[model samples]
Target: MDDATARTQLESMLAELDRSITVLRGDPDAPGDRSLADAGADLTDADRARAMLDVAARQRTAVLDALKRLDSGDYGRCVDCGKPVPEGRLAARPEASRCVQCQSVRERRR
Candidate 1:
C-alpha cells in the first residue's frame, strides 16, 4: 500500500486503540467505574483489561515507529538483517520491523 493509505490505516487504528484505552481505564461516571469488590469476577475483568491495554499500547508504539520509519525512508526494510521486507508482509503488518526468517529467529530466541 502507498504511504498515504498506510498512514490512514495506522491513524484509524491508533484512534480506536486510544478510545479503548480510555474506556478500559474506567470513567468515574461510567459503568466501568464500578468498585473492584467482586474478588473473582472483577479480578478476571481487570486482568483481561490490563492484558488488552498492554497489547494495544505496544501496537500503538509499533505503528508510531513505522510512521517514523516512513519518514526516514526505512519503512519496508527489516531492522534485524537489513533485508527488504516483502510488500505482502507489510500489507499484513505495516509495523513489522523484521523479515519472516529474522522474525522467526527472534521469536525462537525468546
Candidate 2:
C-alpha cells in the first residue's frame, strides 16, 4: 500500500489499540479509581486481565513501532531479512515487523 494509505490504516489501528489498552488496563480517566498506574492489577480476574493487558500493550507497541517505521520509510520491509513484506501480509497485519519466513524462524526459536 501507499504511504498515505498505510499511515491512515496504521493510525486507525493505533487508535483502536490505545482504546483497548486503556479499557483493559482500567480507565485512566476514572475519578478516584485505580488508574493505569497498576496496569489493571486491581481488576477482577487479575490473572486474565493481566494476560489481556499484556497482549493489548504489545499490540499497541507494535502499532506504534510500525508508525515509526512508516516515518522512516521502512514500514513494509521485514526487519530480519530487510525484504519487502508481502502486500497480503501487510493487509492482514499492518503491525508486522517481519515477513512470514523470518517470523516463522523467530517463532520456532521461541
Candidate 3:
C-alpha cells in the first residue's frame, strides 16, 4: 500500500485499540470470586482480554515507530538489511522494518 493507505490503516487500528482498551477497562469480570464455583470461563475471558491488550500495545508501538521513521525520512528502508522494503511487503505489514528475508531469518533465530 502507499504511505497514505498505510497511515490510514494505522490510524484505524489505533482507534480500534483505544475502543478495545476502554471496553476492557470497563469490564467487571474477574478471575477470582469466592462465591463462584467455576471461575474458569471468567479467567479465560480475562486472559483473552490481556492478550488483546498486549496486541494493542504492540500495535501502538508499531504506529509510533512508523511515525518516527516518517519524521526521520527513513520510512521505507529495511532496518536489518538497508534495502528498500518492497511495496507489496509494506502493504502486507506497514509496521515492518525488515525485508522478508531478514524478517524470516530474525524469526528463525528467535
Candidate 4:
C-alpha cells in the first residue's frame, strides 16, 4: 500500500481504538454506580474491563508506532529483519512491524 493509504488506515485504526478504550473504561463521571450487589459479579466485570483496556492500550501503541514508522520511511519494513513487509500483509494489518517469517518466528517463541 502507498504511504498515504497506510497513514489513513493507521489514523482510522487509532481513532477506533481510542473509542474502544474510552468505552472499556466506562463513565469516569460515575465511579460509584455499581448495580451488582454481588462482589464476585462486580469483580468479574472489572476484570473483564481491565483485560479489554489492556488490549486496546496495546493496539493504540502499535498504531502510534506505525504512524511514527511512516514518518521515518520505515512503515512497511520489518523491524526484526529489515525486509520490506508484503503490501498485502500491510493492507491486512497496518500496524504490523514484522514480515511473515519474522512474525512466525516471534509467535513460535511466544
Tens digits of per-residue lDDT, candidate 2, 49-108, equal 789988888888898999999999899999999999999999999888999999999999
Model 4 Cα shift for residue 89 (angstroms): 0.7
Candidate 3 accuracy as TM-score: 0.79
**Total clashing pairs for each candidate:** 0, 0, 1, 0
| Per-model TM-score versus the true fold | 0.85, 0.81, 0.79, 0.90
- Please write out the lDDT profile of model 3 over residues 1-110, one tens digit for every residue: 66677778767767877887788765474455453545677678778988888887888788778767766878879887889888888877777788889989999998
Candidate 2 runs further than 4 Å off: 27-44
- Model 1's C-alpha root-mean-square deviation from the true structure amounts to 2.7
Clashes of 3: 1
The residue-level lDDT of candidate 4 at 43 comes to 80
Model 2: lDDT equals 0.86
Query: For model 1, what is the error of residue 25's alpha carbon versus the real structure, in angstroms, after optimal superposition?
Result: 1.3
Among all windows of 10 consecutive residues in model 2, the one with the lowest summed lDDT is 37-46
lDDT-better candidate, 1 vs 2: 2
Clashing pairs in 1: none
lDDT by residue (1-110, candidate 1, tens digit) is 78888788778877887998888888434454455475568779779988998998998899889888888988888998999988899889878889999999999999
Question: Candidate 1: lDDT of 16?
Answer: 84
Candidate 3: the clashing residue pairs are: 1-91
State the weakest 10-residue window (summed lDDT) of model 3.
29-38
Q: What lDDT, from 0 to 1, does candidate 1 have?
A: 0.84
| Candidate 4 local lDDT, 16-94, one digit each (tens) | 9998988889864565656547567878888999998998999899999999999999889999999999988998999
Candidate 1 or 2, higher TM-score? 1
